[model samples]
Target chain A: MNPTPDGFSTRHRGGKKSAARKVRRSSAVNRPSTVKRGKVVSVADGNAAIISKSFQLRSMQRAWNRFHAGSLSHWTTTIIIALSLTIFGAFTLLLSNANTALDNWTGDNLVTVFLEERTSIEQIESIQTEISKKSGVDQISVVSPAQAMARMKNMLGSEAGLLDSLDDNPLPFSIEFRLTDKKYKKTANLVYEIGTWQGVEAVSYDQIWAEKLAAVIHTFRFVGIALTVLLLTAVALIISNTIKLTIIARRDEVEVMRFMGATDSFIKTPFVYEGVLQGLFGAIGALLLTSLLYWGGQGAAAELGAAFGIFFELHYLQVGQLLIIMALGIFLGLIGALISLSRFLEI
Target chain B: MSSESLPLLIAKGLKKAFSVGKNSSLEVLKGIDLSIDKGEMVALLGDSGSGKSTLIQILGTLDRPSSGVVTLNGINLFALNPKEQAVVRNQKIGFIYQFHRLLPEFSARENVMMPLLIGRCSPKLAKERAGEILEKVGLAGRLDHRPGQLSGGEQQRVAIARSIVTEPVLLLADEPTGNLDSRTAGSVFELLQKLNQDLGLSCLMVTHNNELAQNLDRQLHMIDGCLAEEERGK
Candidate 1:
């Protein structure tokens, strides 16, 4: 559409390699007595024209034109591919940041006490007052069932919509007490001491959470690595398969180019550009979607914190990290093109 | 070092064999020596299985000979690497197959500009050159027509234009007009002769048309991988 590109023109002959430009003058055709042709361009020069750098730029322009000239079906497949990659990238982003969120949750080193199911506000107040008297004690806060539900909703973000079907608040009122690090031994003794209180039905401590969080983080690191490999493989295959179809469609053109002495670079450059562009654009799309989701999450977290005193944040990925994601997109595209092209073109 | 006195292409002791099985081989081209001088158009007459294509493939550097050396413009063609040979093919040699092999996706001008683009000419320069050659082939009015839209004669003419657009030193054509009707073939062949004369283009043609062979400067027959001069001469 943009002036038949070099892709269609990468197979012609050289009349005078330009090296032969000044080397000839004696041919009978040069004398113009017998030759009847009009405006003849003699290539009597021994060498063909040298390949120019501008042709490469023109070649890329051609490739870009072809890349965008696909039908609706082609674009749909590409966008669907971008969406799948976005889902995977978003999941990975969340997984990578999980440790940070866990650290924030465990940072205070607090203990929670679940009161009896029907405990009244007076009974919870008495227990909270009694716990405040213990050594190594930080301030204790009483959490009602409605406040607890609100905290859970904040943590769940968009998934909080699932809570509307519930019959009623399934949680009970609880007391959360923060312990100071300087009296770490006293903190454990206080937690045991509180377990024996009259109104307390069950007690929870951050020590267990601290231990569990560390273990889960370590295990998840391995899982995240495995998922990364699988995600990359999927990206490569999707791009490879799509590009392969294009290559198959143009096999004859490719063969003609090869026979006409077109180099591997000459024939393969456009397809490779297609793959890279697809990957890069796809990656950009995924990153944008991921960012939008994280923004929504950050807002939800802020709302929950203001309403129930819980802390969380979905901090945006740093610039260096974002660049790495972009690099990953570019790399996926190149590898995909290489895989498909190598199989189909045998180059 | 002077190309003026050196032949356009020379092949000496060229032998090619294929492995038909585990230990044995089938010799397609027997040891042979051949040469084409500057601006000479020589026709090689042979039947289908007479090894003419195999010989030309080697001479064109598309395929290497089992044991032989080919020198084009006094530089040993086979001695160069595949990449170098490809450059030579694009710059110095042009080929026309029986089928015209033009890329159907492109217009006549675009198809004609392929070799120049492959050789890395600027797009503007390539376009001008392609227009000139297409005009020479009498396709000035059909530069934008795709191959499918053109008649067989016009398509073959486009193919010839592409082959000669680079002004190659040697043109190796295999049954160039084989796919066309007699009338179309005659006109295309005549166009080829006119090009050979007007541009001082050297040519090596393999054809089964004996009647057409009498018009070239010289004729030779390839019989079972051997070459013998035919009494037919212009």
Candidate 2:
């Protein structure tokens, strides 16, 4: 029998326990056991449930300390996302501005003249020469009825060839004219005056088509604005979801932070900062990609345009628009982080 | 023994059960009664499935008991909401697990300062306290080393420093030495003993090794969710 303080049975597998074992068992007497107090019957019944301000400060510090180590992966994801957005942005710009340029191309004043059926070839040539001499006429080209018919047959295929076999030569001789419209809408008046000529049969113009095209362009501009809004929303959602997944992976860390006395705000602060950082990097990456594509496209268009002594160029996003893009990227990133935390920071 | 006037932790009739498999329930702790005084240390001994960890978790307020009352510094933990419970745990208690559980990405000093910062201390104060604790735990030279860079013993030391930096009322350890070699284990235990004595901090440690259990101030052997025997320090 052995007598120790608060003794029970001294017998065991051996005569004596080791000094380390004695030291290990001695700690049991150091504190009052919750078991003896009869208060902690389960996990829920403890008194240590308050968080102090110091805990929150600690959490913020830990988050900042870990910031650099975790930043690389976050930055990489943001850059990839930004690159994709830039490509889509460039595509949208090309689609919208290309149509704008084409509208301007068609709006330049041009007219077509129809000659009487019996009008001789000399009359058409003289009419072209007379039109070219006019101050309003920039250039004119006379087409003989037979040559016009042959060109139509070549362009329109078998149906047009069949028209050439008709009993009467129904095709009209014509001259096409480019105009310098002082009042912009004066091309219509010029057409009316040309129609009243003795040898002229009729005048034709595409003013109605131009008006309709203008309406279509107006609708396209509205659609482009809507698409941009939708794309930005999508970008924000994607970034937010990604950040949410990251939060899930670090759940244990978050739990530890909470136990360390960190407030919810303290924990979330670094995450928001991280999201903005990622967004900024992503925006820069996207801008770089957009510029590369723009320069390459301009070079290719210029090369193609050189063949016909015509010049082609791409219009880029203006400085103001570029600023908006960066702002939008950062805003979307922040929104994404907010969305992620909404689901994760419940506790 | 815990003084009735300044009891550090009090647990009453704690019961925790879990539903596992289909229509089957297993109770981990059944009507456990415990108390810890300020500056006391107790070793909770148990077999493989004796619910020691569950008990420690509940006492630490990391988890809620299915049915029971726990009061730490006279505050009823079970009555509080999850948010409040988190606040309490953050401020009043510190926990160490079998594994060091140190964040691999952080340096030793940062790891130690986690609880202090989370408890909302000033960065300078947290840093200073973290430095003090690290030095106390024999980690003075490894403050800037990450967990991966430090040896296992050093990492555990860092964990010890982290647990004590907040000056928590209760420090819970779940097999703190389970992963270490015998020599390193002794040194770790020695550090814990020094902290308990020098700081007068309360501790509740769960361990399986009968050898480890016998060295604490008091030992309670838990079997089948009930405390079977208790022995006090000489």
Candidate 3:
């Protein structure tokens, strides 16, 4: 149940062969992994308990050796695979950042309510009271028409003369409030609640623009996933072909293996390990390339953002992302090798 | 498991046929029945295309008989699943070809250690045992030499060392010294005979050499897919 132990049970009785045999029989796994499952006979009762643990280590050791068996073509194919995967990793980071940007836009969390013209002080006070009493409203501030005009004049500075041409103060008395985190749960309901107030003329927030950004981000994500699947299939085919070469080069070895009574799993395991090795290395290279691209992309992205209102900064892969990348590389290689070897091992 | 009193190898009505084309088959072996006792060394002699090689392949379980049963030590070999049959082959049988088919990249000792490694023996023990067998074949000094580096006779010697390393119940060799010179072939055959006697290993070898066939415990000649128990004068 622990998954970490080498899958051995330590309970023991007398020197009964059946008792020792019981420990080996418990594994539901019918097939052996890298380590050949050990035969627990011949050893004493105490020593037999640790046999699975020993074989577990041996399988890993053998796998490591087999992974490094072939070179020239293996290296070339792996490098190409790594480059393709790097492009995949980079796009994954971009898509992640797009979602992050949309979240941040929503997280600004401010609501503004515009008041009717000629609204009295008592009416403004009542509106403020109602806004504060709302479930998600954290703090409220009411800006009078006169105060708003004065603030605009100070902001305009030299352009204050342009506002003097107006016959009367045009700015509306508005109420501004900071919403709590709970505001996002039912943003539309809260907006509707404030708009129904007697003195309120209109209620406005950044929700429309944020929703638009979210839609765009979702579309990009869908496209990115489709592209990634296609690229991964290509990687698998390349690896399968490369492993085919390795298998062909070692036909003599395989022939000898068959003649000597080696099981299909026994012969195919080393090749799978070899594929995994290539995949592991390919993933490491991909990870490094992604890191470098992110580092280099920071300036280019900033400059491109300046031309359009749109802006995003490339985010480097997170720890979880890195783990995923590694897992993907290994899985691809494993699958690629398996796919390749299966054609040759039709028996 | 059946009773252990049965012969080590039993091939009854063994027939092998290859499909030459659509609806046309070339029958290589026709209803051949044979048995070899425990610890017996037997040689099969025949001219080219006499079906000697095909008979051994079927007996070795490398090729399935078109219609027949090969029982090894009372267990029906062909009846068992391929995986189970392979396990029996690994632990119970050894094979040597005319050409020493050692992995070119591996050294002599490593070549011998391969089957033990495949059987999941620890590397240390497999290596130690491989070294011991190489010594037995008088190649103790050639431990590190690759098959390509070893001479014709030495490579054959390494092949012999590998075949006996697992202490198999049966060894199937096909023209083990066909490519070697007469003197080298004689020496290799002598090494094989010595190992078979010293280790109590049973053998079923296929060769065209009458001189070599005369030295075995018995000779069976294959004439056009039919086996004749040939008599010999010492």
Which candidate number maximizes DockQ?
Answer: 3
CA deviation > 4 Å runs, candidate 3: A1-56, A109-204, A298-316, B1-6, B17-27, B47-51, B79-87, B119-129, B223-234
- Local accuracy of candidate 3 as per-residue lDDT tens digits, B172-196: 9999989899999999999888977
True-structure lDDT of candidate 2: 0.71
Error of 2 at A110 (Å): 5.8
The best candidate in terms of TM-score: 3
Alpha-carbon runs more than 4 Å astray in model 2: A1-76, A102-252, A299-313, A318-324, A331-347, B1-6, B13-27, B78-87, B141-151, B224-234
lDDT of 2 by residue, B52-156 (tens): 888988887777788989988877888766655655666568888889988776789878866654433434445556787798898899999999999989999
The TM-score of candidate 3 is 0.76
Evaluate every candidate with DockQ and list the scores. Answer: 0.33, 0.15, 0.36
Q: Give lDDT tens digits, candidate 3, residues A71-157.
A: 688888789779878978988888777677666667766788999997888999998997788777776899888998998999799
TM-scores vs. true structure, each candidate: 0.73, 0.65, 0.76
By summed lDDT, the worst window of 10 consecutive residues in model 2 chain A runs over A3-12
For model 1, residues B144-200, the per-residue Cα lDDT tens digits are 999999999999999999888767789999989899999999999999999998999
Each model's TM-score for chain A is: 0.57, 0.54, 0.69
Better of 2 and 3 by TM-score: 3
